[model samples]
Target: MMKEQWVKDLSTIVNPQDVKIDEPLKNYTMTKLGGNADVFVMPSTEEAASEVVKYAHLHKVPIFLLGNGSNMVIRDGGIRGIVLNLSKLDQIRIDGTTVYAQSGALIIDVSKAAAAKSLTGLEFSCGIPGSIGGAMAMNAGAYGGEIKDVIVSCKVLTPTGDILELSKEQLELGYRKSIIAKNGYYVLSSVFELQKGDQETIDATITDLTFKRQSKQPLEYPSAGSVFKRPPGNFAGKLIQDSGLQGKGVGDAEVSTKHAGFIINKGNATASDYIDTIHMVQRVVKETFDIDLETEVKIVGEDLPTDKNKTL
Candidate 1:
């Protein structure tokens, strides 16, 4: 738990009910494996969220910004200081040809909203399961499209609590990386400019992509969406499959037999189990192909100290 005075101070800025101490993070993450957070605050509005950030900055509390928790893994040792969850900030609005979404809005929900308005550019994101903020932070993509392709500008709250609207060029969006991520800025909202398209075409595109995702990815099990980024010219999944590690298992964590790219929780999987599996896959792939696999999933927090030293 955080200092009582700090918690009480933050409660005055955000909704009192939204504040929690020693909150388990597994329930919020996509992989459903993590320890607790010292303090968790879900602000209902952008202003409230900014206020929380300001308070943390003034008090010298380390603050972690949490979106939908899709492409991240919080280690077994609980995170210290304050964790700001943006889940309550979800709000998507359509204005003319532009779609505005609060940082906490799910990308799939934004795609659906755009589709309802016959917007064509966001079709590729219909199957993405991250929040708009996280997608922007990592320049998230799927099926040949990414956030960089459609985004115009975004509002962000700096670490020092200053809010600024940044253009696409300033965002410096690249393959699974962005300025927002490198600078540790908190995304407040994003504005996307999309073209008008036939409603049938938009719906069909979403359907086709949805089918591809459902068919190729292991959606049945709990796992972080793609364990590693596409390594250079080679696909991570293909490399792992070629290395004969498709069905590898470490405790309750297993490489998906259906898709080598994912490490799934086969019931009762600990964060350690998942981390070990990822390491095993990386080691095998590196040894066989001489390719260092870089992880797309963000692993943070401390590790649990154990007596056993298991080498991959």
Candidate 2:
């Protein structure tokens, strides 16, 4: 079947308005610099999301699940096949001390909701820019706390279209990694277990953390936060800074002068430029300190025709 036919069929299964053809990924990602996706689907409910996954699998089309796009970089050539977005599926409910959130629910929203309900454990996520699904997939952490510490369990849709509930132990979460990412599983929703705390304290903590993030991160530019994972016995930002890689640029992509860990898109940057800058930083850092820098941001799609076979 042709790509257009596939998109049309998907539109029939989902809402016509929810399906977009040749959708520009730049509008969806934080970097604001990617090409068009052949098909973009936003499912408003779990059933609709599951159906889209099943149909795409049966049709032998590639499927990519997009969260808030806070921690990802899509190539300038864009994505082929279907891009499944759960952005419209956002839903959050608080039951006692537990927070039930849909995959599309923003991490910040969840944190705010938790605080309003006097829940404490989620205060650490107040500044995270991604969705619950993306946070769970990477066991995202900040301010000395992580998702795994509060996540009781999560509902996931398998690649084969089966929905399964997984316990925290089953997630196998490590630093900036999780079993869901390793096994190619899609998170449908998550139930976080938090504690009752004083509302004043929670609010103050959130406020303090937000201020710290603004002071340390380069919020004025477009870029994925914290490009590299912290290497063992060392921090990625400290390593880059020590290597004198701050303010380095290739094209419009520059190593942030304020934060060495971030590679900011100064303006009109291509994926190749972003990636090349990353490589250069890595090479220099490794050669100078003998510490191999591993990326935390998920880089996807084809940047160049010749890079189709290259692994991110």
Candidate 3:
């Protein structure tokens, strides 16, 4: 729980105007179905973000580092103490063949910027919609290319507020995970080394990928992207389709008929509905194929309190 004093304290770390009390999380998330955040702190700089973390660490306050909410699901109870975001820090720079991007910058925008400069390696990520920080933490990839392939290094803040520059080898990126996630570090910025390439070829690749993604995915509705990870020797979408879960759902959340890999929120869906749909798919897949379906989405925040409000 966030106390009144904590709110005032956070204002000292950043601009008081940016410190919001009981802010609705639904406005920030892609699902549009979460409870209010107790205290939302949008810091403007890396130093300010570090100060807030250090304060939280010393005071034992529960804190959450919020992203742009493309790959996450926030529960109805919302977040407890402080929720920190670095949206104001968004900046992307291209110097020759290397790219420098702040943590809050959109990765899609970064990819496009790189392509504009005739950089080739980032074309694969042109369609990935996520913050640079989130992408770095997850080693975001698409179309047979991943962030780990071109990442040179990143500046990250440790859980205790110490800053460290991590090399790609130290990042330990593997299969939708990285050291940043394991150590709970907050990424400030990252540098990627790209190569000069033909401008026409890069643009063509992005166009083709964008088309394939739009045609195959359930882009009409809101979703947390692919719900489950690719299991060894098999794909999650194929397995879910084989299990006959498409279009089946709980409340307003349904397994997308267009793509079995995604669970879509068909307007007015609650987080509970979305989560239940995920469990339902997992249960069905397990029973049908005897293989566990590991979730790729990051499910967080608190469930609604048990009372009359509870509904299936």
Candidate 4:
């Protein structure tokens, strides 16, 4: 399967407009960083998405499923193979007290939809920046609630392009982790069971939570949310703050002055700057608290190429 043949087949199967070559990743991610993607595809339907996956599997081309690009950081050197943007798969439906959302649907949108229907469980997600698929992959949570609490089941596309419906237990969701991510499964959609509630109460809750998030987080800058997972029995932000690493940075990537947990792109920051700042935070936190702060945000791709003629 040559690159040209694969692209041709994919274009024929799906719409030609949806298939793009050497697409810049900066336009897709929240951080507004990253280099170009060798190939980028947006599937308007599940059938189209499935076809793309099947072709990628058959060709042995690495397939990367991108959600809203909220919690990810691609390298300056860019990604190899195909980058599948699920943004076109956005769909939302309600049956009884359960809400079914496609992978590409924003979590906040889902929460708002639930609130409109007077559903009670998803108010916490109103401020979450990632898509539903990304949320399910990481069991995204905030304000004392998480995806695991509301999720009943999910539809996933396996690495072999086979679709499977998995129960909550099968997902094995944990603190910012799930079996889908562990097993390289792509989330297609999910069913969430919710309780009946007053619409006013739900809307109020969402508004309050949104305000809290805006006040605390560095929303003015580009960032991948909380950069480090909470260390056991302690918060990562507290650890970084205690280490005197707040407002510190490497290049343009700074430990957010508003929230030490976040590594923000102040202005014109490169992927290397972000990576360097992350490493610095980890080193200082480890030295100060004897705790190795593990990253919550996903970093992918190769490093930027340097000029061979330059000397150190």
Higher-ranked by TM-score: 2 or 4? 4
Q: Is candidate 2 or candidate 4 better by lDDT?
A: 2
TM-score of each: 0.97, 0.96, 0.97, 0.97
lDDT of 4 by residue, 52-156 (tens): 898899889998988888998889998888888889889999987999999999999999888888899999999999998999999999999999999999999
1-312: candidate 1 lDDT, tens digit per residue: 346777799889987888888899998999998998888999999999899999999989999997888898889986888999998888999988999999999999999999998888999999888999999999999888989999999999999998999999999999999999999999999999999999998888888999999999999988999999998788999999999998887899999999999999888998998999999999999899999999999998777676477775
lDDT score, candidate 1 = 0.91
lDDT against the true structure, each candidate: 0.91, 0.91, 0.92, 0.91
Candidate 4 ranges with C-alpha deviation above 4 Å: 1-3
Instruction: Give the Å error, residue 240, model 2.
Output: 0.9
**lDDT tens digits, residue span 1-312, model 3:** 346788899888899999999998988887777888889999999999999999989998888888888889999999988888877889999999999999999999999999999999998898887899999999999999999999999999988888999999999999999999999999999999999999999999999999999999998898899889899999999999999999999999999999999999999899999999999999999999998999988999999888986677
- Candidate 2 lDDT by residue in tens digits, 1-312: 477897789887789998989999999889887888889999888988898999989988899998899999898899999999998878999999999999999999999999999999998899999999999999999999999899999999999778989999999998888999999999999999999999899999999999999999999999988999989899999999999989997999999999999999999899889988999999999899999999999899986577567888
Model 2: number of backbone collisions:
0
Better candidate by TM-score, 2 or 3: 3
Runs in model 3 deviating more than 4 A are: 308-312
Output the worst ten-in-a-row residue range by lDDT, candidate 4: 1-10
Q: Is candidate 3 or candidate 4 better by lDDT?
A: 3
Best-fitting candidate, scored by lDDT: 3
Candidate 1 lands at a TM-score of 0.97
How many residue pairs clash (N, CA or C atoms closer than 3 angstroms) in each of the candidate models, in the order given? 0, 0, 0, 0
